[model samples]
Target: MLEIRTLYDGTGALPAPSLTKILREAYDGELFFSDSSSRPLIVGNFVQTLDGIVSLKIPGKSGGADISGRNEEDAFIMGMLRAYADAVMFGEDTFRNAPGHVWTAGCVHPTFEKEFHAFRKHVGKDSLHPLNVVVSGRGHVDLDEPLFRHEEIRSLVLTTEQGAARLHQRYGATLPAMVHALPGDAALDPSNMVALLHAEYGVKLLLHEGGPTLFSAFLRQSLLDELFLTMAPQIVGRSRTGERPAFSGPLELSPEQAIWGTLLSVKQAQSGHLFLRYRV
Candidate 1:
């Protein structure tokens, strides 16, 4: 078992472990234990500061800085978690806009590709890959996107019956074989969607990588199980006046169930960035 500790000095570097290894450890370390009592799915979230401020010094157009050391480390952590998950869930907007290989860094580690391929294999049973679930209401997705072409990932677009029909006609053979049509507005029904994933696909572990709106919806429905957040030291004080954090409005967690996140670890990257993990 990995020992949990706090690093107050924030100067030393934590040993850099393979992303896949770290993810597996995180699950075996905490999630698996929790699941023994209750079967709530695990979910994770990653966000950059408004000033494009992933780092304090590398401020670029997006907000605070270019991809700072902290941002990179958090992203790598998120990637590892995703790799370990049975399925990677995302909002329709995130899917249509994000570039392919959403979590791949430029690192040439031996395990990077291998871990990703494993996830793909899990999704595409028989020759398929790890299920890539996208939530879209209008079914407005681009079939020619590189994400669909990736052999390591199979895309499952969840939309309404009308939208699914339209997408089927438009994309035809390009889309995944299964297009789930919910009873009501598909995008609005996250709980039902999660149940569908578990009941139909046997996806026991679900990691939701969000784009704010989806996060808000998940929280609203009380469907979120656990939250993994990496809080970088820098602040993004601008370019986000109107935007909201993933969770907005009144927090609904009960006093006992109210969020009690345990600090997992803190690591400083070679680029002088800090990575902090909390298990909520």
Candidate 2:
């Protein structure tokens, strides 16, 4: 087992439980800052290389795993965050790339299934597996994917007016999920999307594991409350002149316009990778 060393912990004054114990079986651990259990507290999580390159593929695979070195510690931490979330929000392209993937504690970190469920029960989640949410502006998702077709899963397609129409015309009759169209004006608005997730789906904590475009939108809209970042050990050098960084899309915050954050905690894995949590 990899040792987890805490270099800092501004979020908690008390000594944190062992990383394994905390990752597997801690529910008294505060996961969100919101008072309401049915409202959304959006948190974004990602792992990026030291070179500021999130993916080596200028047109690479969509899942973070492909670019994140497939570190076991990162997966475990992501599973813990997923265990806390009421729903897992993904960009449409991300959902499409990981064809059979499900956003669940068990799916991401299966070794501690019993412990994860125990923690979920302690937190009072209605279901063990989180609801799957796809956020899309253009709504170009392929609804026929196996994820939506699975009977055991509950999915929400949050898309623009045009995107919703595209979905309804092609797969409305067959898609067994909630297809909600964001108000025409609020199509790309991340805050409005959070409001809808809370009001319609009763999501208290929305965990976003992304494709960069949607993650950047959350940052732009100031919808994110926290960021869990795993700084990977390798340097995947950026080659393209206009290559995509960790968070893609139109985001160029000058030093003054930059988002300020409080460093909540830092955990250093045995392999020298850093697990950092920030309250933005």
Candidate 3:
């Protein structure tokens, strides 16, 4: 059993939880989000080191597991969030980096698979797993990946019109997932994507597990609602090569336009890793 100590919580007025007693004891805290019928509530989850390096950018070890050192509590929290989400969205790079990853509550933390499923059922989620959303502006996703091969998991791909043509030519109608062609060139508008998800899929809570650039786009558009950051107790300095990336990339926010977030809750694992929830 992972022990997560709550340092502070300011989310009392958010929403009341109807979680089962088993989940309440396992989580040892309450988490709720504001309702939005017009659009899905966007929440981001990321883990960075003390030096603010999110990815090592190495060939084989560029995922969050290396940053969090495969912490059990962090994985549990990720699974917990997945349980509450209607869909889990990430960039093409994130999907590529993790070869066989599935965006599901049980896939992240297998030990608590039953608890996560129970939580989802309590919340009235009809799907066995949250929808896996891959946002690729250029349609650069590999169709042979496990996520696409898995017949049980519902997947969606959002890309540009040209990208849709490319994917259609490459994979044709044999592609297992739904390929949506949005009106854009290279970059997709985050707001439009959210609106499409809300209108078509009825996604109330969308989890953004980003790969830096995608997160920055959402932040710049002010479409992101909340951020759940895990501060790993390690420092990996940025090299002169500049391959290592921080939380957000490419888009630099000036002092006048900086987005500050309100702290909602703080939790610390026994391994000194801090879990921070913020209302952005």
Candidate 4:
């Protein structure tokens, strides 16, 4: 929609345009932009170095060379995706490690409450707000986190029934009103979860921000519809040693299906980083 053109070398890029213009073109009249049957349009958003390093130091620490000048670009891409999605999905660990601040007018608020009201209004669901879904198998979340105070934004904690019960018993009063108990281990079933969001919550598009384990689960279940990866020009040689990539080990998918990704767009941000979008 943004006048995309494919380069001869097998790459497509979206020309630089104003933010409002880009949104108008991308969404147009489509209330939803995902496959309805798929329900949740899982967009795997992650940042990695040109050499395939997702994080430079440990999972949450910030040290080492910031390769390829990609951090700002990655953040911009994420902000754009957040602006487009109806809901955002993240692993519980991401919350604990790097709890995100609510985005407001192209900026992120360090605390949640100040921007909470405006964020709900932006999504056109001020009554309940766009769902902030967290997948926590063990139900280990800090009840006193700033996210809980924002009543305007409804937070949905997806866990096993047992886990849900534990969360209730521990922080029932502090927890959000919509604590859904999943079918068996309380862990969310991707297919079932997507169905619930569509059938019950009226969410048409979902953006998944991963922390590897959850990413692996979605891929293993074949629930991902698209992947938005930002290949930063940096590398972290140590990341591969301890934990494997999201799709590592014995996962099965035909070569065509497994490697099926169509280039959508590539743009160089003001910070000199590349943003890539692909349909998986």
Candidate 5:
């Protein structure tokens, strides 16, 4: 097991796995948004390589373990964030990569399950499990996957009208609680989708676990608040295949549309990975 040491924290200097104190304060509604009006504060968490690869463009498989080395510290932090969130959100491609997975705290970070749930209850989450939300403009998801079959987690889908119709044909009767389609031909609007999640699900703090393109959408929409990024100690160099970077897709934040964030916190695990937090 790798231990964590805080190099710098905007709040104060403190070490981690004892980092829970910092997380606890954030969970107490102190760190999200001070404003009264907004469509829920959006936070993103990801681990990437020193060379900036999140996952390789392997033919049919997707995993960041090769890049991140599957560090224990990262897993524990991931679980902590899931517990802190009202819902753990993912893009369809990322969810599809793990066919047998659920987005619940236990599923993402099982070793920390007991403590993770305790923290959830500590933060006064009405349900023990955070909702599992997947974004897919075309509703490209595995209806038979464990994301739906999991009894504890609530699941929802966001897609286009035509995609909804197709999903209805395959999973009409057994569809998850909601299948919200975008208006007209407007594909999936990250801001609008997030606003709906806040209005409908009472999600005040949304956490995004991404597959590049989706992260790009949030960036394009300026809906992201905070980012927890783990800088792993490997170098993926370049894609042997035409792979994507940590953020993919057509959405661009050009020079005029640049998004900048202030550095907030930093930590280092024994494995030489650096964990950084940013206020975006």
Candidate 6:
């Protein structure tokens, strides 16, 4: 069994109970979130090496599994977070990285599937799985990917006007996911995307599983409210620009504009992986 030891928890008292006892025990503590009414509460999850490398950029080994060394505890924590989110989102490149992956609690950690479903049900989530959201500014996505064809996962694509036109021209009504075009040519505004999810889909909690580029955009715009970071005990050195990428991507923040995060909770697994929660 995967075991997590809570090292510190500073999440102030909240009104709503988010996790079930089963999940709490497995996680070694309770989980809570402050409510947001203006826009969808956006949270990002990432696992990085000790040296701050998020991906090795290899042909077939670019996913988090390699970074976390296939740690089951990290997967369980990610699955638990997915259970709390109303929608799970990622950039197009993230989808391309994981070709056949599904953004659901059960898909990530089947051992805790029942507990995840029970928690979601108790929290009044109607969908069998959380909505899958993909952000593709240029619409350079492979529509035939397994996630697009998932019957249970209602997928939504946020794209630019030009990209939407391209998608319509190529896929038309045959496309299984809903494509929403926003006013832009290259990059869609993160705030606008959050507003769309909050106003249209009632997405109170959105989990961001990222490719570094998308994460840079969100972080630059200050759109991410919380971050769940898994610190894997590895030292993957990045020698080149494209081979190994940092978690911050290309958006360099000046000292004056640098954002600081407030630590909410910290947990450690037996395998020396650290799970950290931060309010940004």
Candidate number with greatest lDDT: 3
For 20-128, candidate 5 gives per-residue lDDT tens digits of: 4545543221233332256777889888888777877674545655557878778767777788788888888888887687777777667677777777777678888
How many steric clashes between backbone atoms does each model show? Answer: 15, 0, 0, 6, 0, 0
User: In model 3, which range of ten residues has the least summed lDDT?
Assistant: 13-22
Candidate 3 pairs with clashing backbones: none
Instruction: Tell me how candidate 6 scores on lDDT.
Output: 0.89
Which residue runs of candidate 6 sit more than 4 Å off their true CA positions? Answer: none
Candidate 5's displacement at residue 162, Å, is 1.1
Alpha-carbon local distance difference test for all models: 0.54, 0.75, 0.90, 0.57, 0.75, 0.89
Off by over 4 Å in 4: 1-19, 22-38, 56-59, 62-70, 100-129, 244-257, 270-272
Tens-digit lDDT string for candidate 4 (1-280): 1222222222223343223433434322111233455476677677666666554435545211143342543554455566556677777766676554432214332223223344435546434345677778777766566566675556777778787888889976766546777786645677777788777887776888776667666777877767776666554564535443432223456777565678765655444456566777
Residue 222 lDDT (model 1): 62
Clashing pairs in 6: none
> Which residue pairs in candidate 2 have backbone atoms (N, alpha carbon, C) closer than 3 angstroms, thus clashing?
none
Question: The CA-based lDDT of model 3 is what?
Answer: 0.90
Better lDDT candidate (2, 4): 2
Better of 1 and 5 by TM-score: 5
Predicted candidate 6 versus true structure: per-residue lDDT over 51-102, tens digit per residue: 9999988878989999999999999989988998999989988898898998
Candidate 4: residue pairs that collide: 49-234, 159-186, 160-185, 160-186, 160-187, 161-186
Give TM-scores for every candidate, taking all chains together and pairing residue i with residue i: 0.68, 0.88, 0.97, 0.74, 0.88, 0.96
True lDDT of residue 240, candidate 1? 38
- The true-versus-predicted C-alpha distance at residue 77 of model 3, in Å, is 0.6
lDDT of 2 by residue, 128-156 (tens): 77898988878788777777777767888
Name the best candidate (by TM-score): 3
Off by over 4 Å in 1: 1-40, 50-70, 102-111, 115-129, 173-177, 238-241, 244-276
